[model samples]
Target: MKKIFIGMAILSAGLFTSCSDFLTEEPKQEQSNELTFATFDGVNKAAAAMYGMFQSDAWYDGEFTLMSELRCGNAKNPTSVPGSGRYRSDTQWIYSDRSTSPLWSYAYYTIARANNVINNLDDKVGVDATQQQVNNVKAEALFIRALCYFDLVITYCQPYNYNATEDDKMGVPLVLVTENGKPARDSKENVYNQIVADLLQAESIMADDYVRAGVTDKAATPTKPAIQALLSRVYLYMNKWQEAADYATKVINNKKYELAPADAYAAMFSAATAPEGGEIIFEVYGSDKNEYWDNSGWAHLPYITTTDDKGSHGDVCATKDLYDLYSEGDIRKSMYKQHGNDYFPTKYSGKPKDSDPKYTNVPILRLSEMYLNRAEAIINGASIQGVTAESDLRKIATVRGASQTAAATKQGVFDERRRELAFEGHIAADYARCNKSMTRKDFDDSKNKDVAFPSYMWALPIPNRECTANPNVAQNPGY
Candidate 1:
């Protein structure tokens, strides 16, 4: 998955100066995809390039994800000393800066790449054995596009429940074509509709027998399971409880993955390779050797890198709130490392003394989430036999070496999710959709963290650059 620009050819032309009969090669730049998607092998490489976009600093590796964790309140800037300016705005909850929302441009950039591959697939005349190639490639690209748009909208727009009359709220621009267009902000419903449509269309076209290639260590590439898994997440955000549960079940029931047992849990965190355990439903690979942009491991990295091992460590510390949630001897609590008084997550770092590249894979979705999603849905209203909120609670508790909670309640589910998915990027979002505020206004004792709505403080503002350049763009209220 790390092979940069694996096989998407760069088309160029040169004249033969010593020609017996003058010959000039036709330009290929105009028909780049003609050769790029000429066969299954070519299209496969193009798909890899599409997936590679996640490695950029804007998406998984850096700001796009880092900002999400900052607001979770589980991890805060060091207490005694103010840290690096890298994500200063984020930790302080001042999303007024343009850089805080890097996903805005990078996501659209990736979408354009996906469109290039997807738009070209339809006109492949009568090529040999290219139908399956086209189908597989198109499905993957559509999944890529949907994945980006989902991340973008969630960052830029208010939560689905932000406005009772949801039709009036604006979402990030829904760009679908390769050619640039002066697009205006669309309604939230329309943006979500496009996301759902892309994912469903992707699911329908994917080969039933399709097994994602290019990685054996983890689920690096998108497949039917990944697509279904994300649909579950998108539905959850949309507040479609039943649909979320159903789609989650589709991924959970598939025999391809399983949860990493309690005994192997420690190894799962500091895994030298992309993990092979059942828990990793989907992930993005990073380098222990090269610090590529969007390396996927750095989202949890500390602000400073002055440790014994060159690990990105100790800049951000887990909050007392998150630590208190773990009673005792819970495997999930041990995921964080303590430094004097501050505690930081070790899931993305190496052991304190041991030296390694510190590059870790980012788990985009996991089996545990399926159970949680279903449990929440059932607890809310939708009922599914053979599983209850309590059952799901016990399932995760057993794996984490924690006492099994017999009764399920709204708060119980929220607490369990915080314990299970902390620092993995859901902390803030879970609170937002539930209309909950940060556990403490200022974890670092700074008086600036405010979680009030009309402020759009929780929801990021449209980047200043975009608002300036695009006339049709409308900034969020507070900004």
Candidate 2:
């Protein structure tokens, strides 16, 4: 299907929130469900509500992305002179409940909405709607649901390869319905399989034959490339290197997206509107005054609020090690501005106010990821179809100016990924998928050290609120 970008329209519909042990879907208002599935416009409005979950303080627009890098040692909090322990727990992986980490409930909250749409859409139809239209609506919900589960599993479960046979291990429960059922954790293997099933079905239903005749929003909707791109990441996590490479190759060969050139790379982030075609396959849009994290917005994150801030109140700085990864002439290197010990990247500086939303169009998938995924997969023993791992690495590195003298290697792929994806999330999961341990021993700040592989800390504890409410819900071991 030729993909069309249906820009995400914000809805006034009330969103669902979970209060039970396991996730239970409830509409934001009474009769909301009845109206939601009553007409096609209503179902789409529900879809917009799912996007609201994406705009939340805990999920993509904020902490979920922050947690990925913070716990992985890409960011830090100031050394409190005393009393004020701002980001201590986060940087130390000290999160426990939904209070500190809102991702748990919000993820399930998103999944619940998706289930509501998928299960109920059949009974409700818009005027003059075709089966294809209905199927498209359901496919979008499935994609969102699959995305939520993918995020939840990676956040709350240990690395997939933690056990040679991980089918018996626990992940967050696979809640496929909206009812208030108190379910125990499903195996990580099972959750992964479910994600695959959802993504494949989603792919099957999208209008593959629909060709884009006009412009479209890059992140507003899921596309075949987006589904394929996500499957690449999912397979990478599963250690299915061949599958990862294959899916990545599929995206790269589709000819739908061209990587933003080095000069254009920084501009892509700064576009007042979602920019014209580039490498982005999927993203979420939020502004300073609207759908932002805190009043400060997504840009308010990335750095601590500071009076002397250039673009952002620099809270989160790039680790010195991350800052040092860039070589001269690498356009990617210039993205960060080092202010003393703190470095702020201008990628999120779309609206440069002290507290305004950075106008960050949150990137969920990009062409660069596909190249990186393909390279890493090939290096890890996947068969090379059209290009070698090194060739793909050079494709990215050369464009970024990092390959002027840099040679392609397994480590080179890691370096490019870490640099290319910095602050856009994917840091910890990168380590997890590789079965590598993350440590903060190099951090200049006080306290915590290694977040070792195969540990309970790897899986965030099931929220205390849920456990307290539902006897069937089990807390993560050692939390």
Candidate 3:
């Protein structure tokens, strides 16, 4: 039954660019030769596939700019592969023809999935069975779509395109329809408006009850918490600090999720029970038999282990800066182990007891992050208070073994975020907020051995495909 669901789910969800004039047609199965998405299960399965894209090689497998491009900080080493190492130019303060790079396709591929879900969902059938269920499903789809758009805008377009006369700022293609036809880019401000609209509607629709956070039941969908969490993150990126603080506070005060204990910190990254950890508000589970290990294998493992395990791609190591960041008594240092001069990040450490290698589910949102974000937002946007903001956030991380204290300043909050959320894809965003830059020496500990922030890398260049195919699309200045 699970296999059937996985298979139908992949077929029903769209994950490629729609750049031709192909007409929309219902997905047909070989056995029945009939459209298969009229049922609720069919639609649900399709949505699962779209959510699954977050874990694929396109985004998390070290291919996505989240780690590869030197847009944020230095990589641990110059030991990067072909498609992933283009950001080295940024370290040298050079920008060339990266506008035509291949990484852009990942953005479009994700957008295609969002388009498929938005296009195929029909209210007529869904409303007949359960209006609430239908709305919940639609809300989940919209949230996913919004996430894709948000990623594209931050990655490809300039930061808010603040000065452009509406027409000059190139936004991503807003392909709301599933038809295979190219669409021109929207303005940056226009794209922001759409993103805000999607999140607002999604929160309203998801206000009711639903299941998320590792619940694999066919009926499960994103709930209000997930929507709110993403909203807080979006607002933070947009510099809407008050709004970000409000949403972050909302989730923090809800009192539903709690941070794991100090002992459970290691378990939070353990493959065995990570999905069950109360902190994980959204995550993707993986199985050895399936292709969806969330790229934990590719992102965390190093090439040529001391044991000489050639199983995983020979890449990814924790830099000495990250290693030295841990204090002498901090228990968090256990999360990584030294295999010599190089330290291997243990967030996805292989399983114990000689079983098949396993990695924890990729965590998308967690309550601990909410605490840090609320603290940052409060300090950035509102009046500074010790107990309410700084003390409150520090209390949690302290109990959870984070060695840092909360300070109500940009540097303090920034450092807290870096140490606490390290490698969870939050540091790159921080670079944008502080407007900092980094160097190749930072990338490999052998050179800089210290961390520096590069502000320009915060807004990633729009994927190469959009600029090449759409004449209206513009590339980021330095790329």
Candidate 4:
């Protein structure tokens, strides 16, 4: 594994009084691991830091989200709008070991932090914390580690079903504990099995309504539903159709969440605080107060999707290919605003304040995805009583004011997923896992417009730094 090195600075208890403050605060200096994980407060701070680390540009705040869209057909760089020239290589499918995303290092850094908490939770549970409290902490760490591994495996390895025999295919390294020893990549199936095991363990420990204390934004933390929702996605990727459908049903049946209605759909994305109890299962909290916020600057998603006149980067725009997918009365069409000849997504249209673009929350998982996941699974031969692919798809289509035409078929479910989850970072994986080739008609580069299924380019190259540091780590094919 890549060297797991991070300063062990436990913030003062006063620093994490609430979610906003907890997410915004940065650790000052290195402390000993013994002191950092000695108390419940200390362990809580460590878990909070794990959530905060996701705001880095390499992860949710920028590249991880935008690159997925850019590489797929949903996003484009408009010639009319001025940009920072970011994501151009991704849009054109131009990648190399050096040019590949920095998500690898960032994810490992987060996993290491989570490992620190998970490894120490049991031993430290006595005076300052109860067993239940320690369990919650461990659950959070497990969820974070599983999420990071899922992202790494999907990015650095082919789809779970890429080959008939999975033993030959390698996934990213599985570093369950914080250690410095270099490790070779595990098989894709082993990596997925580990993810499922972690999530299931987390789900068992956490209460159905367990929300982390001090979190003002419930979506920032992992609740039981959130874990189940992620399991649904993971199962879908693993081609466990029945399991995927069942897990999606678990999330969908949870009355705590409901899909955002048509009128509130666009606003959900732009809310300064993540919207509570409507569609959002998990989101990356964005705030000017966040330590990484200022550094993100023009590279942020809000800036990239907004207009130049709005005092943002105004680079990424919605292609006609995606825009045309919505019917005449579909409310999702309103999420895009045209400037000259370009149509920019208003999904990240900034928050309510003057510094709007800087503090916009990014949704990571939502209830709409559960419906889509279930719908896709059912269409692909999953069984759920009283549920047809059409009915589940209509659950989303009705809210978006879209008519359900051909939602009973696999192609229709895929189209609905693209329509519902566009630019949220599902497109590339959806295409790859479903074995569908991407043909971008609206893209300018004709030579590189289409990405065929089963291509080696589906898996990104492992970082050169990782390869240099760990001779055991092998680069992905066709780097």
Per-model C-alpha lDDT, please?
A: 0.66, 0.68, 0.54, 0.79
User: After TM-score superposition, what is the CA distance of residue 118 in candidate 1 from its true location, in Å?
Assistant: 1.4
- The alpha-carbon deviation from the true structure for residue 77 of candidate 1, after best TM-score superposition, in angstroms, is 1.3
Give the local distance difference test score of model 4.
0.79
Task: Show model 4 residue runs off by greater than 4 Å.
Answer: 1-20, 23-30, 164-168
- lDDT, model 3, position 279: 71
- Among these predictions, the greatest TM-score belongs to 4
Candidate 1 displacement at residue 318 in angstroms: 0.7
Runs of candidate 1 with Cα error greater than 4 angstroms are 1-34, 37-40, 80-85, 97-99, 164-168, 216-218, 272-274, 288-308, 311-313, 350-357, 404-407
lDDT, candidate 3, 240-278, per-residue tens: 877777787777767666777777777766544343426
lDDT of 1 by residue, 301-375 (tens): 432321224545455667777787886878877776666566667676643335443445566788889888888
Judged by lDDT, which candidate is best?
A: 4
For model 2, the superposed segments whose C-alpha errors exceed 4 Å read 1-12, 15-31, 78-85, 97-100, 123-127, 164-168, 209-216, 288-312, 352-357, 404-409
Error of 2 at 316 (Å): 0.8
TM-score, predicted candidate 1 vs. hidden true structure: 0.85
Report the C-alpha displacement of residue 18, candidate 1, in angstroms.
37
Candidate 2 RMSD to the real structure:
6.6
lDDT of 2 at 320: 69
lDDT value, candidate 1, whole model: 0.66
Q: Which whole-number lDDT from 0 to 100 does residue 59 have in model 1?
A: 64
